[model samples]
Target: MPAKTKTSFHKPATWSDVAPLLVDVAMGRQKADLVVRNGRWVNVHSGEIIPATDIAIAGGRFAYCGPDASHAIGEGTRVVDAAGRYLVPGLCDAHMHVESGMVTVTEFCRAVIPHGTTSMFIDPHEIANVLGLEGVRLMHDEATAQPVNVYVQMPSCVPSAPGLENAGAALGPKEVNEAMAWDNIIGLGEVMNFPGVAANDATMRGEIAATVAAGRTVGGHYASPDLGLPFHGYVAGGPEDDHEGTRAEDAIARVRQGMKAMLRLGSAWYDVASQVKAVTEQGLDPRNFILCTDDSHSGTLVKDGHMDRVVRHAIAQGLNPITAIQMATLNTAQHFRLERELGSIAPGRLADFLIVSDLAALTIDEVYGRGVRLARNGQLEIDIPAWSYPASARNTVKLGHRLAAKDFDIAAPKGTREARARVIGVIENQAPTRALEADLPVAKGIVGMDRRNDVCQIALVERHRGTGAVVNGFVSGFGYTQDCAMASTVAHDSHHMIVVGTNKQDMAAAANRLGQVGGGVIMFSKGKELALVEMPIAGLMSDERAEIVAEKAEKLTRAMRDMGCSLNNAYMQHSLLALVVIPELRISDVGIVDVTQFAKVDLFV
Candidate 1:
């Protein structure tokens, strides 16, 4: 192997001037900082792969890309022997929540960077709902400190669904205005209150106005699948992109309405395949489609993959490889208006690229961020420090007292031997759950579980302010045969304690286990606590390193899989029990929310 040379070039006046800079770097007249030799460059810009190319980087940005080696190389430049690999741009997740990883922003970055995710558009809505504007700022500041690009999107729906469940703190239009002016804020977070937008609610309109005034993107979440008048009304509300689509038609409708359709593949949500078909088969313009992972837990990032998984799934859905990569990279960057700075591996863009053995397999042989090698062969070469959350974020699981089985008992209508109970059925690989009604036998004026119908017990323990209130209900779809239970204080948006179980004792044990560890996810089986992932910060995230959190999360996931539950990515479904926005039925500190109507409803009809 010959020694590589360094090269440098002045900023080009136009895209037409790039060829001269490429020649200068290749001739080594100007020293380049680093060189990657002999790779298949997947140019997402032109949708072509120029074979046997070399890439040069300087000042953390791509300085040159071509077939020659003489000009760009200098005495001190570092050379990476690509040895015939596919060079692809690092992925960018269009919309996501860092808190969903059960780790801090820094930890989440550490987990995903090695998997070739160099940028993300994150919404701190979960923390904003817990700690208010201060929480959003905290996450924003931390995100900026990372070496990779982690753009913040100001939370638009702090309460998620007003009047349905109360958040610890709320954000109004003023907060939105202030966040839009922040330096690293790319846009407004997901407008979760879609109904409010369609209804022309003043608060929702004000928030949108603030974002538009600041020239920032307004993210969307039209969770309802009904493409009726309400959907049209929401389209008129000015959201630039939407990731809530689950079907091909849903995606097509969004694009037709002038919204970027962000198809997603998260831990629990397998929505990309059904929706990406809109681009692959329906003749929809692929430029309007984006790829994202809305809520990937640490286990999914570490043990499986990050945006790489989404890209692979998209390709598996019959999309062209380059088109799928473009969705994860350039399309997302363009959506956030960061295309010039970070998307493609070209001049003036951040030098983030993945060296892969095969384009289709996406076997990342080496990963680079900010013009430096960060990981090689699926292992991190750099060490990222653990972040410290405030003491106020600790022990958020403040139930006033120890919980008992009686607290979980849902009483039937007076003097009735049987009553019609409202049940929430968990849907596999989807966010929308079913609203089921079942008649159950009564014992001591309390409705008993109808195991034949797969109805199990679900409880929401009030953690904020130590209310010690346990609102219990019934849920179906987890075919738990043994006396097993699972609990988590990492409930979405509100960070409350949610426990689901087939046995009362096990449910109590699971809830108590999380309480003992401040907060986290725990599973109890046959009187033994089987798994726990301790998230001590706000009862929503662990302060430990990402790898540590990821390891624990992997165990918890395996435990769920071993317990006779086969719903794909059930842990994510477990975390959303307190998400009051998405409808059908959900539990919160107030009680069960009939999400369809955005109101509190009695557990027993």
Candidate 2:
């Protein structure tokens, strides 16, 4: 009897099977799955520019890449004419969050695939804070089903900063260990509790130990600007990489201490240029650094590019084009320890690459994933099946009762004409805010917003537990000239409801509007609802398609601008007001957070 013949598609491909399959294709025993002829390959590993190469793929992995691949091709093999285009490795986001895009995992994937992003290491901590273990599972399950590589990092900090803010759900060391066992989980998410780690808090250390014991990476988030003992202590606590660095020194410190400095260029966080100077001008090793977009809104992802935009920005910041590409592709993959599988265009790596006409402009004309064409000409060519989130993942907003104007009223000191109040000042294009103090007038026994001073009232309404607990503080960033308010349930780290407005009535209307729509961003001006962007999933992610969501987000941004808020991506800035982790001031259901002091301070002084 003749021996049985092995065939492609007999089973799911693994690393062990790739070699044999490549050998079969190279020897002409089995046909190549796909072939790309005549392309200049961007060799990130060797830092060389090799031109006119043919690449053969077998079982979704690169079989051979050389001057010619005619022998590997058979009658049934698919061929892609590169037309002398540059075959760069698929872009990888080193650190990011799917929830930050205000879309579900599937939608976010759909939006970025055309931008040449193939691999993403996402931290679902935003949902983890809202729905806990269950929310994480939803993001994880959906991420695994996507066509692109979406690896989950178990959220290390649910509330982000312990004792600072209260989250709907909490994740402990046990939860961290359990998530590490997940099939797609790569490592621990950003350890935002820098204070906890620096102070040798048992919980933070236990979480780090659990991830390290599982042989996975521990992500970092040292948001503080202190590069002194506190920074060193946090580094000693075992975080493998950090994305919170804002200056060149921050990057130098992290890389010098054997940690990957992940410089981010999100819509609001312009941190890459300052940090990339560490390598470009200071002549540091570029391999130890990575580029990422920690928080990009859907509007930014749709209008601007994803990793491609980050790479271009790095290039504009004086990084060589190849070096910038390496930062986005190879450096990112190495930091996540996924280099062998998904970073480069090597023989054993997955056949994920981009065909670009212009390297400097990054004009991506085609994107191939696992040797199959996924997108072309800035549009997805393949179908990404819709993922329907369960009812448990929807309608998470639980305000309990309708909010009233009185809920946002700030009571002044008895019989006082004016009083000094602490204000959470929003900074444009940055995460940290100024903890400013303002002496404001009192009217009808209530403190009033000073529109002339840009001081608007900010409130954090409890949504997770339906506790009707509203923490009020003053903010002076959105220059509201009219009686308008903007409210959203997509507050970072805590995922509570944040309402900022010049008028108490408008603030109440905006907060109640989100409750009515399950959860989303709502803007009200002069007793009329101006715009609403619904995000029913965990009050954090929208179930809509990317284009629709982007349109709504644009309208929302326009509405904010119409209401006199001039900050770029003001909604993103607004949503982060409740992020008690970053300094210098923030709001939580507990009270106003003095992040610089790491304590809750009185709203009135």
Candidate 3:
């Protein structure tokens, strides 16, 4: 039997046809598809904030925006009185990862739309790492079905660092070529391995060549801050935009090299304030700057906001409100070659906008998407379905058997009372970690964690197969107290289980909890489970609704805070334990990576 038919919305042919419809709606002679009256239009195009404006939308596009609305009140038109709220263009996140939210695409959209985010440029590299080209296509198809604009970027770095990571799937030039032909694919995802680009690696060149040949954007991820010859070489490699800029100089260099500098402010990474200085202070062109949330978790989106939080942070950093809004809206849309359909409240653009009370505070009163009111008064009005991931995507945590306390014990060199060990230090609200060496005492020829030194044991349990190979090490900066343990299967690219705790038994219990539930994040304190988010799909996202995942994540974060961990958004730092790409230190299924040197290293000295 044939599959159920999908609903198709009408698309306007040109602006000429859209203008009279706008006039008819405003004059109240013809009914509008949806009308938002008495709003202060925060027009990003003209950089003006016009008060007492009315907006008319039809066919999922803006039909009119003006002061009068007497003619657009025909029968059967859905009318929403704005009550003098500011009508700003729908926000656009220039770069992000849906997997980082720990929820599926349907859920991620539900979490952010109420916060006024109507468009996103997502890179599904995490799923691609586990399921290859099929995974990327699945995400693309799902994103196209959404009412909001969810553009997919083809995964550019599957393994991320080839020869360094053994991912579930590998993508080459063939995959890139195929993805380029997809309808919703915006461009190539973040080219993470800048070293490979500079060294002229064949795989990197081949993927970039495919994307360039397709006339699409090549996203960049130059994590290194050094603005030298290698930086120049990376720019020459054809990435048109970069979002890893953490400093003012990094932003300046990217703009100078003709690339849009994306300033991100996610849960852990507070990069926007530091990098936006290039435009606000160094006289760099504002057009070359964009705003994004590179890696926001579900909790951050539900508790705080999405691009709204980033724009507020930029404003507090002394940037003009208009400029910040522009960075998050039009600038992002232009970068992805989607300026015509989105990023503004102009005619022919998607009817997506936020009704706000104040520009500085960004107090959103209502949000509209596809000519419909999806959210109002900080709550979602539309009901989104739970995304169904294939059964093969579940039970990814194949730890063979339950983990034991002995698996977490790191044995010291023979006949040594003490040893100098390499510990992974978690830097609060930052991506780069500090490589710290500590001298610790040994017990029964094994290294022990020093509670007084804020040191805790960290274990990477191989979950891809039933290989219960647990590699143990030490970590700092969590400030976890009361013999607690936290375990998650959302460990970076590989999505392995990373457990950190001061008590050995708790570490074992935490790992076992994830194993029992298939895969998810869990916190165990004093032998009692505190919180868990069941992300059974590929061990990264849940089949549950987005709100349910957000609520669970909130509980997990609050549990962390109650455990005496005060670092802002520490959960994000916890999930990056197995990233294996960020500098200084990271853990993978293979071993701990000294990312500064791009090589694996011994855990003890």
Candidate 4:
């Protein structure tokens, strides 16, 4: 009734209520709050750059956007001279996990604001796995309070793959319906349970029904490469947007099925190059393609850029500058059904825009959100209030006991000198891993890593429920040459502890060190600590500023390199080693999972 009584920093007033104020400002009956004059407006709606444009804003919404806005300018108005720079809509990230940046939502906003990302559609499922609905609520509140528009998508799949792994929390139809009523919720998050949806599972379908009934978009994750019946069946289940496509064919299929194809580029996921070809090579309408950074590392956010990086990559893939900007801006807004609210420089829309000095290289000179200058020349112009997570959200790294070096021992079958084991093969800059078979040596009843074969031991230590259970497996492709171990509590979907090491004692020390510090990633080498990034919030995000986290992340990557590991952003690959939903192979608290089969398999095959 009456639009469900929602109010937040993201949606402070309905356009109907603001229309009168806009009319007064545009007609010079009232002074505008802010004005940007003498610019070239990049009209996403018309697909043209009109020179000598002016825009007037009042009440955080654009009131006049035309050749001139001098009529609304008054002594109180804050006037910004664009000096003929291109006025572009503030970039939008259509799909992302804020926690993937390893920082809280406030810090994420602070980090990306200077790079021209004014809106983000974030999925809090990573937190939901650790703290359940309480965690989602915490992130939802924090996101709505930010200066930029951060819309929450109620996490659809918590455990991600039911019956495959253990998660700290679970969400069903009840949680979905409850979150739908939240003031800042934009839609349901990526339905990671693709198999369940394809199989017509009632619970999964019912979550989609609830979001549709609430009139919100449903995010999709068809991680499989198959475009046959299962893919069609999943689309029939009602997810209207997907960011999991890693190929041009994947993008074509998703768009053909009436879903917006989101090409993502993040710390490790280099998908935009392959999938944007759906538009650049296949001649599909570019409007159906959206750009996103599904999982940006903190270092990438600070050193590189956020959505700005994605747009640049898309342009490099041979898209016109306006077309590339549309993929990151207007197309994203249309996909989320928020076109009139943001994503374009037009009257009655939020005054979220960027001043750009170059169209092709896309250099952002200033960033604005809600008619307020947020950043200029790649620096924050205002203070973003710090947000604090409650104590319950902290201290989430629960190890049932102080893990001992002996606990990491993978004892081979008695009397076996060597063991033929299944190993997860890590491919550089990809989410999926390869299932390979390797022969490893065993000594004194324990299986040892084969550094000669580039194989190491991987363990999934149960953090949720703290059962003290450890699932052991072998993994390759890290190329470690010394006594080094790395452990992380930010395991995907389930948030378990993933430990990969060349030796047991170092692995044990890495795991125990995380237990001592609440939660985060730690690397140990030769009985010494190498790198640590403290993620105290639900074992997924740090409460500090993103710059600080970025610095820590840089040091962490350097440590990985020093350990002789040669993968691009190997920490991202390490964190996702336990994501049972992605295909080929993965490890979980139960055992190693053959994701293509979605079934648990033994280590020694």
TM-score on alpha carbons, each prediction: 0.93, 0.97, 0.93, 0.97
Better of 1 and 2 by lDDT: 2
Measured by lDDT, the strongest candidate is 4
Q: Which digits, one per residue and each the tens of the lDDT, describe model 1 over residues 327-421? A: 99999888888788777877767788999998887888888887877788887777665557778767677778887767777888999999888
Query: Which regions of candidate 3 fall more than 4 Å away from where they truly are?
Result: 1-31, 67-73, 76-84
Ranking 2 against 4 by lDDT, winner: 4
Model 4 Cα displacement at 520 (Å)? 0.2
- Tens digit per residue, CA lDDT, model 2, 33-66: 8999999999999987789999999988888888
Candidate 3, residues 536-558, lDDT tens digits: the string is 87878887776678889889988
Q: All models: lDDT?
A: 0.84, 0.90, 0.84, 0.92
Task: Compare candidates 2 and 3 on TM-score and give the better one.
Answer: 2
Each model's number of backbone clashes?
Answer: 17, 0, 11, 0
Show where candidate 2 strays beyond 4 Å: 1-12
Q: Can you give the lDDT of residue 511 in candidate 3? A: 88
Which digits, one per residue and each the tens of the lDDT, describe model 4 over residues 1-605? 11221223445566788999999999999989999999999999989999999999999999999998999999999999999999999999999999999999999998999999999999999999999999999999998788889999999998899999879998999999999998899999999899999999989988999999999999999989999999999999999988888889999999998999999999999999999888888899989999999999999999999999999988998999999999999998988889889899998998899999998898999898898888888888777778899999998877889898888888898779999999999989999999999988888999888998899999999987778889888999999998999999999989899999997889999999998888899999988999999999999999888999999999999999999998999999999999998989999988889999999988885
